[model samples]
Target: MTEITLETRIAKSDEIVAGKIDDEFVMMSIDNGKYYLMNPTGSRIWALLDEPRTIGELCAVLTGEFKITAADCQKEVVEFIDQLAARQVVKVG
Candidate 1:
């Protein structure tokens, strides 16, 4: 398992295909044939992963986009990314 830290760079896994449904996303993993759902916030994060980004970068972007506190943003983003990592739907380095 990858240790997720502020400097960890993350990217979308190539095995997954994602489709948008309004604000949410439905993702299918071609490698495992597993389906997953991402809420609006998760969908936004997925779209941002067009390139690898450090956790801090993602936090910075989210802080700028939402009214949440920096601490809260980091905490929640880490948890959400962990879920994605657990599913092998994202790559963390």
Candidate 2:
């Protein structure tokens, strides 16, 4: 499994096809033919992944946009991105 660091740049994996439904996101993986459901937060992250951005940048943006503390934001964002990366839902470089 790949570790997500502050410097890691992440983007949506090419194998994923996603769309929005009633304020949430639904995604399908072409590689495995699996579907995923994501909340608004995950959808926002997915949209931001349209272009490669460092994990630090991602966390900073989330912290500013959301009402979360920096420490919590870092921990949660790292874990979330790492999980998505591990599943090949997002690409990390």
What does candidate 2's lDDT look like per residue over 27-60, in tens digits? 9999999899988888888888879888889888
Question: What's the lDDT of the predicted structure labeled candidate 1?
Answer: 0.91
Per-model TM-score on C-alpha atoms: 0.95, 0.93
Q: Count clashing pairs, candidate 1.
A: 0
lDDT of 1 by residue, 11-79 (tens): 999999989999999999999999998888888899899899988999999999989998998889899
Pairs of colliding residues, candidate 2: none
Highest TM-score scorer? 1
Kindly give the stretch of ten consecutive residues in candidate 1 with the minimal lDDT sum.
1-10
Model 2 misplaced stretches (Cα beyond 4 Å): none
